[model samples]
Structures are given as C-alpha cells and as structure tokens.
Target: MEKLRYERPVINKIKAGVPDKFGMSTRINTITEIEGIPVKDIIKGYGSPVFVLSESKIRDTYHEAYRAFSTRYPKIQFSWSYKTNYLDAVCKIYHSEGSWAEVVSGFEYDKAIANDVDGGKILFNGPDKSDADLIKAIENKSFIHIDHFDELYSIIRISGNLKLKAKVAIRVNMDTGIYPQWDRFGFNYENGEAWNALNRIMLSNNLELVGLHTHIGTYILSANAYGIAASKLSELAVRVHRKFNHHIKYIDMGGGFASKNTLKGAYLPGKDTCPSFDDYAESITSAIINSEIQPDHLPTLFLETGRAMIDDAAYILGTVLANKRLTSARRSTIVDIGINCHWSLMIIGH
Candidate 1:
C-alpha cells in the first residue's frame, strides 16, 4: 500500500520587462559556458575575477575577418593594433595568424620587435613620436604614418641625417559624414591639407611615400561612410601616381569598425544594426576597386581593427560580491573586479 503525500501549492510571480516596438523583451540569454567549458569549472580552476582568453576564438575570428576582405580584394594586409590587448600571448596569436604589428607608441613598437615581428612589417602611427622613437623607426624602416607637418618634417630631417629613405605615409582625416569626426589626429581632406601633405611627402628626398591612411571615426554604423573614405583615399593615390609617377604600396583604412556593442540609447540591437565584416569589406573594397586608380597599380588594402577583433575572445570573469538594495530602491550586484586597472597596459592606449 502506498501513502499519498500532501503537496503544498507554490505561487510564482512573473515580472514583465520593458518591451520593444514589437512587444518583445530584449533580454539576452545568460552565458553558461565559453568554448565548451562550463563557467563553474572555469571559475573553479582559474578562480573568479580572472581574465580568460580563448585562443581558439582569437584564431577563428582572425580567419573570419581575413576571409571577408581577402575574398573581395586581391591585395589585403591585416595588422594587429597593439593598443588593443597587446598581451604578449594575444599579440603572438595575431602575429602567428600573419598579422603585422600596428603600433602607436615607441613602447608598442619595441614590444612588437621583442615578439620577433619583423621591424619592416611594423606600422608606426600616432601624433606623439619621440626623437628616439623616430630614429628606431627609421633604422628599422617601419611604415611611419605621419600625423602632422611637425612629424613629417621631423622624419624628413631624421631620415636625411641617417642617410636613409624612410618609408612614410600621411594620415588623412576626412569628413565621412559621421558625427564627432576624428579631424584632430591627421591632415584634413576637405580643406586641401591632405593633398598638401602628400605633395610635401612626394617632394622629400629622404622620405618615400609608401601609403595613404585615414581613420574616419569610431563606432560608425554607416558602411557608406567607409565607401566615401575609400573613394577619397583612392583618388589621392591616383593623384600621387599621376603627379609623381610613384605608386604607393598600400591604402591604410585605419580601423574604426564598430564591434557589436549597443550604445546607451540605441533602439536597435547591435547585432542587427552594426555593420558586419562583409558589409565593411563590400563598401571599402568596392569603392577602391571601382575607383579611378589603374587596375594594375591598385594598392594593398590594410585593415587594423582592434576592439572588433579581440572583444569577443577575452572576458574578465568576476564573482558577485554582494547583492544590495539602494536607497532609490534599485537592486544592484557588486562585483570583485574594479575598472581602475588591468594588465595595466591593456587599458593604456590612444
């Protein structure tokens, strides 16, 4: 004989979240694992508050991005932006994936060299290059992206003193119809500053114009803006070839490609709105390929995307320290990690 057990009735409360236009809550599914490893196991092994980087994911992402551009353009070169992550392991992973180094500081340049990156393959870019940095870059024959006239002339002077033809390029800043234009870093395209800088580089005996570079803006959702930038840089390349009979080695579309992070006020989900690798490839490649530049003399396309490449590969794993109700009656969880630091240098960049 079986005895029937008395059961207690349980009540459940369902909380309604704010819904979007279609009346669907945009709640994201929680992550339970990364790369087939359970979060519990990972925390158990490495402890919470540790940063985990999936090497497999990094290689996969690099290959995916490389494929997106390579399938569209014949000459495409990818450089790892050292400021993003720049952990020796991460940098080595990218370098092993055939990405050259794109450094914005003497320290990064040195780190790249220490990583056994060929000095000639490194790209030195930024507004601040010390005299010592210039000498090292010149000695190494790295691609020096000139930020201003001061740097251009300084490189010319240094190169002349060293009796070496420094491989140089001017960073062209253009109005790509994007808000908060990044006009402060390089020469302006609309106001003839870019052209003037090109002419100055062409006129220098100690400097060889190797490329034309432009970094429009960051987190740009518009693919057409990249098309505009590509077209302008291509036009500049054509003009340089037509005027000086010197073909530039590459067109560096300095990376500002947005990662899939929704802004504070974004109505649409980032996955739905942000441009994909294919979208950017189509825009930039199509514009350059269809430009007035001769087909035979088309320059190499260089992409140095950072955040988009490494964002998904690594994560800061932190355990919740406390659950508290604020005076405003809002619920919040305090985590172990503070934003004040990292490998320290990972957060230190331009």
Candidate 2:
C-alpha cells in the first residue's frame, strides 16, 4: 500500500459583513506552466526565483501598440525605453524589431551605441546629463531632450565650443488634470517657462530645436490626460513654427503608458480598469489631429512607452517558502521571490 500524502490543515471563519461587490467568490488559480514548459521542470533545471521572458509576447505587444498608433497617425516611431529593462537580450530584441533606443543616462547611451543603434536614432533624455555625455551625443548626432534650463545652457555652451549644431528637444511639463504633477523634470507649460526656453533655444545658433517632448506621469489611469498633454505640446509647436518659421520635426510623447498591473487601492483588476493601447492612441492622436497645427505640416509621432510594452512579456518564477498564521488567525504564504521580482509594483506602490 502507498503511504498517505502529507497535508497541512487550514481553518477558515466566515465573518458577517457586506458581500463582495461583484457577487463572485474570489478564487486563487494555480499556475502550473509557462510558455508550454512546466513550472516545476524549470525550477528543477534553473533553480527557483528565476525570470522568464517571452520573445513572441514582446513582438506581439510591440506590434499591437504600433498598429494602434500608426493606423491613426501618418508617421509614428517607437524608441525602446532603456531604463525599463536594460538587459542586453531585451535591448537586442527591441533593436531587431526596428525600435530606436531611448536612454535616460550616460551609461544607457553608451549601451545603446554598443548595441549598434544609430546615434541619430537614440533619444537622450534625463536631468543629469554630463558635459561628456552631451559631447558624445553631439558627435553621434543624437536627439538630446533637454530637461532643465541648466542643461539647455550647458548644451548651448558645448555646441558653441565644438562648432557643431546640436539636434535637440525641450522636455515640457504641463497640467493634464493629473494629481502629483511631475513638474520637476521639465519646464512648466502653463507658466510660459516652456515658451521662454524655446525662445532661448531658437535664438541660439548652435542649438536646433527639432522636437518637443513631455512625460506627464507614470501609470496614468486616464487616457484623457494624454490628450490634454498632446494638445498643449501641439499648441507650442504651432507657436514655434509661427515665430521661427521652422517646423518642428517631431512631438515625442514620452513614456509612462500604464501596464496591466493592479494598483494597491484599486476597486477592480488592472485588466478591467487600465486603458488599452488603442484607447491611448485615440486620445493622443485625435488631440494632435484636431489641433491648430496644419495637417500637411504634421510632425512625426514619437512614443517611448516602456512599461506597457515589456511588463507583460516577462514573468518571475518563485516558490512558496513558508506558510504562517498571524495573531488574528489570518493566513499568509511567504514566497521566495524578492522585491526585485516585482520592481514595478514597488514603483507604483501596488
């Protein structure tokens, strides 16, 4: 006779209260496999606490997002954001898919160059670009997104000294009906600071303002917020063309497209609550198309969507380390996966 399998005893106490709003019992499903491979087999071979990324999923997500925006806008380009996941394999996959590199620091810039991405295709963005970084970017003919006034002056001074014209864009921060505004990274749009910066750039002989960039916020739930942001940037572009007679090359709606990850205090799952790519594309494209800017002179749409593009393509596999009962007799299962496994959750406080 076979020995009886061991099992842990679990006790539950029903509390009297309002039932779940959805009128459905919450169920926990067990994940037994991933990408046709058994989870246990993978853990046996590679050990626990491993990360698995699906190449097909990445391509699918990218094409889905591309289709969403390209169908609405005439010209659209995607620059894979490096800060999201800088693993060489991940970067190469995006590069192979015809994505330009969008890096936020000197190290990431170098990584993009090392990955054989065309320097001109790279969009350099962030607040802490060093003089050396600017020089390298200028030499590579990269599109440097100026973050603050100091960076603008630094780029101007460097370009003047090198006798080279720096292809650049100014990062604009504006009110998009979102709370906890990210006004620290770029010039304010409503207060005329962004316009002032553009004026300064236009007057400079070495700096050529080819584009306008803005990243409203991260994991933004409202797609209308993006529409408002696009409208403001489009207005600025029209103003620039009117004053300088130079049409901007592109309008970079910087990343922060929300991924399908549930927030901490959410009423529904992210899959049900988060906006889809098509939703976001419609909001942003419609705003630009309806703006005062001429249709014939419409600029290229550049998106640096990071989280929404890659988050779902990757999964971290871990094992249950222990099970415990709290003082209130609540059950808790501790897993081997560390905080690093779900870094984005920490970022969004999920």
How does candidate 2 score on lDDT? 0.89
Compare the candidates by TM-score and give the number of the best one. 2
Q: Give the TM-score of candidate 1.
A: 0.90
TM-score, per-candidate, Cα-based: 0.90, 0.91
Lowest-sum lDDT 10-residue window in model 1: 341-350
Q: How far is candidate 1 from the true structure (C-alpha RMSD, Å)?
A: 5.4
Cα lDDT tens digits, model 1, 1-350, are 55877855545345364435554343545676777777767778767666778888788788989999999999999999999878898899899889999999999999999999998999999999999999999999899999999998899899999999999998999888897788899899999999999999888899999999988877778989999999999999989888989898899998878887656556666777899999999999999999988989889999999888877776666677887878986666798877653532211111
lDDT of 2 by residue, 147-184 (tens): 99989999999999999999999999999999889999
lDDT of 2 at 163: 98
Alpha-carbon deviation at 328 in model 2, angstroms: 2.4
Q: In model 2, where do residues sit more than 4 Å from their true spots? A: 1-6, 9-28, 341-350
How much does candidate 2 score in TM-score?
Answer: 0.91
Q: Worst ten-residue run, lDDT, model 2?
A: 341-350
Model 2 clashing residue pairs (backbone): none
Please estimate how well model 1 matches the true structure, expressed as its whole-model Cα lDDT: 0.86
